[model samples]
Target chain A: MSTTTATSGRARRPKKPITLVGVDVYVITEDGIPKFDEYGPFKIEFISNRGTKVWPGYVSPDLMLVNWYRCRFNATRPVTDKDVDAFVGELGKKHQWSAVQKLWNYGDEAGFSKAY
Target chain B: MAKHVITMLPGEGTGPEICEAVRAVIDHTGVDITWEYEDIGLDCLKEHGTLLPEKTIKSIAKNKIAIKGPTTTPIGTGHKSANVTLRKMFDLYANVRPAKLIPVLKRPWDKIDILSFRENTEDSYAAIEHMVSDEVAQCLKVITWPGSVRIAEFAFKWAKANGRKKIQCVHKANIMKMTDGLFLEAFREVAKKYPEMESGDIIVDNCSMQLVRNPGQFDCLVLPNLYGDILSDLCAGLVGGLGFAPGANIGDNCAIFEAVHGSAPKYAGMKKVNPSAVLLSGVMMLKWLGETKAAERIEKGVDKVLAEGKHLTYDAGGTASTDEYAQAIIRAMDTL
Candidate 1:
């Protein structure tokens, strides 16, 4: 009868290390691709146009605008939110990107091998 | 002994031309002011890698008082505004702009005299913007309780000191609940202590309408960063254009007085611009320095020149060169 206990009261578990981050930035362009550049330490895995991956990779050209771009970067080491924020902050200034979002890669690896 | 060691920046383009006008008035004051000139804006940027050099910061820190010309801020996205940089550097949290009819300038509202206090440091002026997605970009509007309280306190204290009867807080709290809410909340708290002055809050849009409809009803107004930025300019238009508006960026340590107008690069050497804004700013600087006599003297001289209506810039509806208008003010001081 007491076997089923409430899990809602349990403390939140710690988040896994950030292995990857997806930053969404707004720059005004119709093509939606940032000029490819070495990000230093972190490698730019791919860039996406709207929702479709467009760089280091390709999606249908019909679905891309040059102004908005989502750049995904791969980090060898697990990154903290602070690290991601600071990294994005620097990148934002350099490229004058209007927005940035950090996406984490954890749990299991999926797409890279299949895409490669 | 010199009353104050003030830093004077001639700035870029027409800046130098108008600054000379202020210099003439300063000389007539007989305040024995020691002037330390500094280079800033486009000229300094070209010579140095940065728009705001370390030397300029150090000079303001040392002098604690500066009177400057309008530096050119590039339109669109280029170098960040030097004025914004200086404001952040010194933590100049209060931007005070007083707009009043000068009798010389022909305007609809002759009785419009509004003293506006704008919170300078926080809100969108922080410039912390980032793109959340390529399609969605966001600039963070930070409104802290301390920032709000300090600005409100400054407004109330200023109102009490200046004998201003009513103080109005301008905000868009209904739309921006949290940020603008914090601002209005703090303003109300600060307004409580100043029982002598009547205080109220007006939604920014309505305040704009009221300003245009009946500007005489407003005695003093306090606003958050972006609203203040737009409203101050609108208030400036009530009396005259930016050419007639003088601004003071003040903090605990330093105060910078300057014309709120832009540097008209096309008319750099033409000397056909109004120097009233910069000269009035000098009057403000003198007032801040406790050299009230000198301040009043300069203001009266300016009043005389404006009343004479003979030697004025084309912008002010006359045909006097920049130097000629300044000479007129100085000559008026001689009579004072």
Candidate 2:
């Protein structure tokens, strides 16, 4: 499909209410903690809670942000594919974390190595 | 009729007929024209040594406004770029181009109306332009806090004044920080003021892809210098062509609106040229003059003439020559 059709498709999809409590999502071992926080090279900031809520229209409400860091983070290298997989894996294996009513896990933006 | 001097730097390879068209405006308006005319030819490369002369620079600085037909920037040439020099010297921070669906001309998308307020100075357009090395020549991308804040502030103000609904700050800060990052940060700060308008920050790459795909979703795009230049041209294409796209170079004390397209040398001297870009730029100039009523009349005339969809040059999908199109617009003005 055209990029328009795809982006419009993405824009219109209904999103479930989800929040990334920065505390849990950034646990050191599950996903590498962002340590080089020397305010980064510049003040790249997350201005709003813009992406945490996914709008996955007719399909199931996507709890996971399609672009994982869409939850908001600031850095130089950009949030990578490996980062997404780690977040999904960490949430999937623990205390029914991935299936929380307020949030659910879609495929990690990184890749499709099945968690089941 | 308030008289204002608009300097035209046709330089070399400028066609004869285009000169007459510009002269016609001066004669018709009966305005004193301060012709900042100079033969900034190849010799200019050897002497005071620039494609754009210090004389033209002083004229723009003194008048605070000017217009031009076209200027050729020879690629890989030793001479510095005239346009880049003026844009930087005057600190003309914001390059504002309005892309409206002209009354006729049958556009592909109705929902597309975008005003691009591109950062004019820094970024790759800084003309810090040099060959970094034999294998890897480079242009620096320097995005600053003040640069970003100024452009973002202008975009929001522009949106507020024009009744636009949304604003999008396009950048590639995801990878290139320090420069693009500063712009993004300023957007965050300034955006807080205009809560009325919905806002989103898009990666410059995604914005480029989407603009061609769905020009509809966008309204106002504020970006760094290079992205603005590229995107504004794309917007010009959507409405009709660069011929219909009017642009304004604005700073704190001054504003210069002009024909955004280049001076097409091959088509020079042949009255078969399109003056839509220059005339539309004139309309913008009037608006800048605070003569909104005259600007409205000019715009309405332009709309009616084009809506009739006849008397258009090659670009506007009609057989009419340049003068014929201008005549139609003048007629539209009289009827109004």
Model 2 TM: 0.68
Model 1 regions more than 4 Å off: A1-116
| Candidate 2 clash pair list | A13-A55, A13-A56, A13-A57, A14-A55, A14-A56, A14-A57, A15-A54, A15-A55, A15-A56, B70-B263
Docking class of 2: incorrect
What tens-digit string does per-residue lDDT give for candidate 1 at B1-336?
566789998899899988987898788889989888888899889999777677877788788889999888888556778887677556678999999977877777759989999988778775544433333445657687877888899888887888889999999999999999999999999988988889999999999999999998888999998999999999999887998899998876788999989888899999999988998999999988888999999889888888889987898889999999989988999998
lDDT by residue (tens digit), candidate 2, A53-88: 121111112111111221122223443335444544
Q: Among these predicted structures, which one has the highest TM-score? A: 1
Best by DockQ: 1
What is the lDDT of every predicted structure here?
0.78, 0.62
Compared with the true structure, model 1 gives a TM-score of 0.77
B114, model 2: CA deviation in Å?
0.3
What is the Å distance of residue A32 in model 2 from its true position? 44
lDDT of 1 at B204: 97
Give a tens-digit lDDT track for model 2, residues B49-134.
Answer: 66666676667666777765556676753445566555655567789998888757786776778999998866766332222222
Q: Each candidate's DockQ score against the native complex? A: 0.03, 0.01
